[model samples]
Target: MDTTVSVSAEPEKKPPTLFERLLINRNYAFMWVGMATSRLGNVVFDTALLLWVATTLARNAPWSAFAVGALIFIPQIVALLMGTFAGVLVDRWDKRRTLLWMDGARIFIVLALIPASGLFHLPFPSGSDIATFFQMGCAFFILILLGCCDPFVNPALLILLYDIVPEDDLPRAFGRGQVLNNLGTIVGPPLAAGIFFTLGIQWCIFFNAASFLVSFLNFMLIRPERNAQKEEVKAEQGAKEEKKAGFVHELVEGLRFVGGNGVLIAVGVSLSLIALGAGGLNTLNLFFATDNLHATPDIYVYLDVLYGIGAIIGALTVGPWVQKKLGVMSGFCIPGIVTGLLLFTYARLDNVYAGFIVLFFVGVSQATFYVSFGPLLLKVTPRKLIGRANAVIGQLSTFAGMISIGLASVLVTSPLHNKHLTLPGFTLGPIDTIFMVVGLLALTSGIQAMATFNDYKLVDKQEETPAEKSSENEDVSQPLISYVGRPGWLSTKKRQAAICLVGFLVCLLIILPVAFIAPSSTAATVTMSYGHPATGETIEGMECASTVATRQQLRTHLTLYVNGHMAALPTGIGIVSPKQPGVRALASNGNLYCLYPLHVFEADNIIHADLPDTRTYTLGQFFSVWGQPLSRTQIADYKADAGKQLKFVVFDGKGNEINYTGDPGALSLEEHKTIVVLYNSPDVHPTPFTDWNGL
Candidate 1:
């Protein structure tokens, strides 16, 4: 009797859902609460600030539009001036501390604004032209201070989110965040209006400060970790690299990268045109409603409320549904098209109710477009340049918006001021006419965006299985036997085996001579697999790189816990920038930089194994690429604290921690096998590296 064994495939495990992470996760909870509280506060504060400028400081002034518009314009100016260096700074700063500092600084600034703006009720007489100008100056200064905080705040939020949540959950988290922000926009403006009219500007300032204080406290409570001062000492090499590539160099590099990439340029163009229209709309929408629609100012405010509600719906439902159906590009492109149509319709509509409905859809489309941008940015951006890229991308929109606001102010003051054009059926004034022009610009942007979005397809399509991929690869090589059809061409098992042998022999015949004749100069380094080494062979500092796409690039997760807190992995392991003098490394094309086979792209746990050939890489080899010492007694320059033990543990894919007895560096790095090094804690339970999260 012959018996056959059946093999069953294990079902793939999914990452914890967003709700699960929200309920159980402490780190994420703190971040979410803090972000939610502050975001609403920021909107309220902004609305109040603008109201104060318009109603109090710039009241009855002939150049009141310029006074109010300058406040809006200053931030964009600051971003253009300071964003590049700030991006690099955020990359190096501690993520938690960055959040704390951003909030803390704003709290003080707002508090000072209360006194500086004379909102606290000055003893002297009020409402003089000089007094009004002083108050405006104070408000402008506060805006400048807040603008400086943005470069740190925005990039840190994204970076910290990367640390707090798994990679797969990022899109969901960001989507929810967008919804929360839209809700804030809906609620904040009304609240601010009430407080400004009833409680006074001082009260608004107080509320803003209180909100920031709450955020600061939450940041203080987030994931307690020991930040040893010696970490600075350990990162000396990285610091030296930073010093070599100073702010000016990085600024130039950022400009070059953003300007050179076609995708980013296309994206920038799309965003700029849309922003131009939005800014112009913001500047003139009130006049459009009051004059064109003959609506009360209070009733026109519902336009924003309706827009915010629609945005929330789009972010939560429409955005994801569309992205699933037609990919992330469609989430952006489709929304852009819809938004353009809505803008044009909004301009033509004379009924107030119709205006609200049209603006609501406009908000939906705009929010969907913004929500989709995060994923698309991640898709195109290199891991090494995320911080710098984030800083610069926003400036593109800001640049366009600032210019539009300035130009909008000019158009109304010039000969075109309120010049109503009468047609057979419609009468168009400067405000509505400008909006119509803005609509045309939006339409052009949408068309341009669609042109760039042509190649991307449905995002929800199922991924190909490994077996299917193998069959496809085989089909490319073998001509005799068709795997797709006619499987019975070789019926007997013997005939199948014979055919396989022939194909294998044919592959070898074609490949063997090319392998022997392949140029040694193709790579500047030799392949050194784990457990096999030639005598006196050394791959010390900056010695190994293939300089071309390899057959496979493996990854291993390496985590370190110092006194029970997770440690941050330092960046720039394999890279050797050419600008650094006295650094001996091979010059590549354009003599820009060189790389090692084993290196890390950023400050993450994933260690990239990009050697010349496919083989098992060891933990020791990784440390060698890092140019750092690794052993039971030491990690880089770190040693066990007094009375503490250093334990090295390897966790398999299933999260089972296994302690091995041997040289720590000799341990082989299997795919997603987390190599954990714990210092100063012997009794604590090992926290497994859960998932690489598709990294």
Candidate 2:
């Protein structure tokens, strides 16, 4: 075997201007447009679905927040496996057709959502309290399926772009692609919100499906000549001999290639770490809005818009400019540093306005990173190997995301003895921890980029044909091993079971505390009386009590009073009580009276007596021995039941009443006690109730 690298002759022609260049290259433009359109549709659909799940469908579920994470992570996990097979198929078959099929499949899958929405109208399965579960479940399943297919779609498109674009134009092509991608970021969220508001979430899915169909049609229009030539050459050469291999082998080959190429390896690892940090921060943004910023649901759109505007700026300005002026590594590094600093500063910001400013910069940095890296990766990879290379890089990045998720999950939810002290002033929720982690990773990636600036020079110039072919084999070597090893942690069975168990336990733990501490204290009262208007006769009785009892206790206590006979009266005569109480005491001359406390748990108790006769009962009827004279207002309202007496008992921490009935659900025992002390305490209020009933 010849080991020496061979060089291809350099072309002797000047490159066209960027605009002219893109217009002349139909393949690059088509792929760029298709990818951008597809991505926009995806974001719109995903944002809509997420909003629906969070606000309408799974809104009440304990695991609602986890649904979003599952949507992101499940697809990534599937992508790792499917992406490898997709790479193999793209290499072995027509790349354009592979992409076409992927897009077509996505269109159909999203269209299926139209019927799935019908499930929402179905009578919920009997015994289920949360009816939206089945509908949301269907959505989740569809999203997972989409995730499975996405790996093939992304890599195939990238490889196709590499196949059609000349080496020198690759960076600008990718930069333009990044601009289009950022344009998607700009359009997606607001479009989704608008569609969701006006047309409902189902229509967003339909629109996304339509976008996929359009992208598929565009893919079909692209010429397949270059892909066909590459496949024909490979077919003539026959299958390259391999030392026995599996998925792990292919995966490792990709890993090894990335590892061997210092520039590629640094880029991959740095970006992975950066993703770990940035993804965690993004994950916590919603929580930050609600918890820290005190934002309601409606405000999220404005927040998203702020971030989107920054992303647009980065994509349109920083992204293309950096790709042209600085090498990709420097472009990535600059943004990485800026984003890190901004994120770190965000941690210090207590005001929501400040957070918005920081997040905007964060969005810009993220856009810069994406645009800069895409072209850099394409520059190092051969056209034929781009699919596998991306698969491997994607797998690593996904793995990094998974790790970040796990870490953030632990940091956010884990109970710490000194949680308040762990991060001073800021209530360190899961999001706070995630932001800190992401910031550190970004700083590390930025520093690493600065350290490895020299290595990127090797990627500036294209190699000769023989040497390029050799590098392709080298690039593929590590990925082969990564593909076969099937990283132990990525096992679907283990991950699913573990996630379910942990989620279940977390739900149980969170619910238990709420169940223990969430009942409201109630205070209610009722009154009844018996008297004759023509004769000066009256009979009135009153009792006051309070209990920290359950609802059953309150019901039973009221029932007993309502059922008991007073002055030989029938049980249903004229008992007046709250809904929890029942009826028994007699009524006469349009007057009603019954025994009840003015306060139930924590309320003021008032007592009054009056006869139905043309005469008003004096306070002496109830508290005749009291020395203080009753106020005229109090005298007019007082009423007495014939041959009945009134007595007052303090329940202390229990509901109590005087002359007036308490408002239902008025106050807790603590509040009543505070009010009572404030009103009656000699030190605070010199005027006290002269007589409990007369006051």
Candidate 3:
């Protein structure tokens, strides 16, 4: 028997998943996990800190909120000041050790703040403007200390990455690092919001402190073995020789390397301008969230959440395409333009939901610009000069940001602080004015970036058509007509990227307005007849739920009527009121009053809202808008102290009365319908509407 020997085809190899690919390297995987843990802490700390400043502390002095924001950025300014020197120092040190020590130091520093915050409040009179400023000062000092760690930590981390990963894997390693960072960003805000609203600011800070410890532990576990130690020694020896070359000499060498590079100069200038605009916008976002959008702490968290998601999308999907399709410089220009337009749109939008969409797109554009710019900077610079080039860019951007924030603080607080300004050409609020200026700056930066792209310098021009394909051949070296050529169609990679970029933006444009844009004229009528023992006076009008007054003012009024009952837990929801401390805390000073989009108890005695759609809204939502609780046992403190249970009777437009107890807050309202919230005895029932003429 003749036996034919056959070899089976090799089993197909499956591509590694993102996590698998990232974690394949033992060191990077540990660092990434640590980074994620650290990010969660940062998010929680930031949210709690901001809420503490914006709501808990700076409730009276709104400007102090800006001060809190400005103080947080103070560390970035410090980085700009010391970044070059710090880079030089970082190169001399063992990066892994440096990272470990820095993380350990930060954990202790953050932990110390919990006690420090309380201690700082001791000397200052509580609930006073002075106390607010004192609190802000404490925050500023803490942030400066935190900021000081970044320059050391950031460069060390970068160096460690180079030391651990092979040259071929650097890009993948950095990409993984960024993905984890964004992942932290996306999850942190909402988590912080949940904890802040429930467990309070202390828990948030504690969590953040713990995160740093986790990161430190992960760094401790990174073992690069003998090769890493050797590289570190080599680096230190090189650094020592470079030191003998003199600091000025080394600085000049790096600067000279960048001097001839046109792309670096263009990117630096463009980014500086963009940073200035961004700084102004960033300064205003918190205020805009509370003041303009009338958002509570929970809603403000969405801004960070949505932006993080958009950034992730941009980084993973859209950014690569945009960067490839548009040359790096041109790509920067596109995001700048789009960002400017989106900011303008954001300034105009009145709805919080719409604002979320605008912020999301803005985030996408920013992410694209950042990812594209970094690679280009790295690609063009000599390895030796890279640190200095980055430092220069960082300093310039920081300087611009500082100037813009200072200017914005002044403009928004005093000089241009007005609800509306009737200038010769335009009319807008002080916030809107800042937004307009920033938008224009971004646009200008985009134009400047676009102008910097040249075929001979950075971008490769498409080869000239062969003589056979040309209409006619010019005589050898005749002076060609100098015509500026537009960039040719992008490569297939870029085209695909562009499609993804446009897809997100287009989807945002179509979906948001359709879902949230309400008819300006379609008003809803809300009538509230609430009083103990049948006072019979109906409190109606837009004032009850109108979000016209400042949040502080609305909250003050909300506290007066809703009182302690607002924070009480729903009885029928399988829990008792005051059982969970978190629920109890949420009821008090949680910005719950801001939930009311319209003032239901205005002098008009009828809450009028231009709703997006005609869907029936629950009475609970109405109570939420009124800054009151609606549950089985309570309705805005009505007879709650008297130990009386709450009840409700609802009449539809057709005079069909529906009586319900144990949380009738879910009851729906209709045109010309009547809802009576009764406490204790039900002797005085609500009369049904016989005529619909009064609606």
Which predicted model would earn the best TM-score?
Answer: 3
**What's each prediction's clash count?**
0, 65, 18
Candidate 3 at 281: error in angstroms?
1.5
lDDT of 3 by residue, 1-695 (tens): 12332223234556667766757578778877777787778767876777667655554342653565575568778877677688878988888888888888888877766754553335432233344456667777777787788889888988777777776788787787777777777788888878876666667878888899999899889987557666787788778675566778767866765555555666777788788878878767766665455465577778877888899999998888987776665666689879878887787654678889988998899899898888777656644566788867877787888887887776665544433433366445556556766776676566555655542244221233554223233231221112244556763234433533453354344323322341211121332233221111122232222122222222211111122121212211101122232221112232222212222322212332323244555556556544556676666555465565555666554446666654566665444355655455445434442211111
**What lDDT tens digits, residue by residue, belong to model 2 across residues 1-695?**
13332222234455676665664477666766677778889989987886676555533233444555655666667776686577677777678888888898888888877765642445432112233566677787888789878867766777777678765777777667655766676678878878875567778988898888878877877884556667776565465434336667766766666656555666776678776765555555655554445444445556677787888888778788887898676887788778777876776554667777888888888888887877777776655557567767776777888766655544444332113222234334334434554666676666665555542353333434667656634444322111122445444334433433453354345333323332211111223222311111222332211111111111001110111221111122222322222222222223322322111110122222111222322223322111112231221123224332222112321233323234212322221121121111123211111111000
Off by over 4 Å in 2: 1-33, 115-120, 125-130, 162-172, 226-268, 302-309, 315-334, 350-352, 370-393, 409-426, 448-695
The local distance difference test score of each candidate is 0.64, 0.53, 0.59
Query: Which 10 consecutive residues of model 1 have the lowest summed lDDT?
Result: 520-529
For model 1, residues 421-441, the per-residue Cα lDDT tens digits are 445796555566567767766
Assess every candidate by TM-score. 0.58, 0.58, 0.63
In what order do the candidates fall by TM-score, top score first? 3, 2, 1
The Cα RMSD of model 2 versus the native structure comes to: 16.6
TM-score of 3: 0.63
Candidate 2 structure lDDT:
0.53
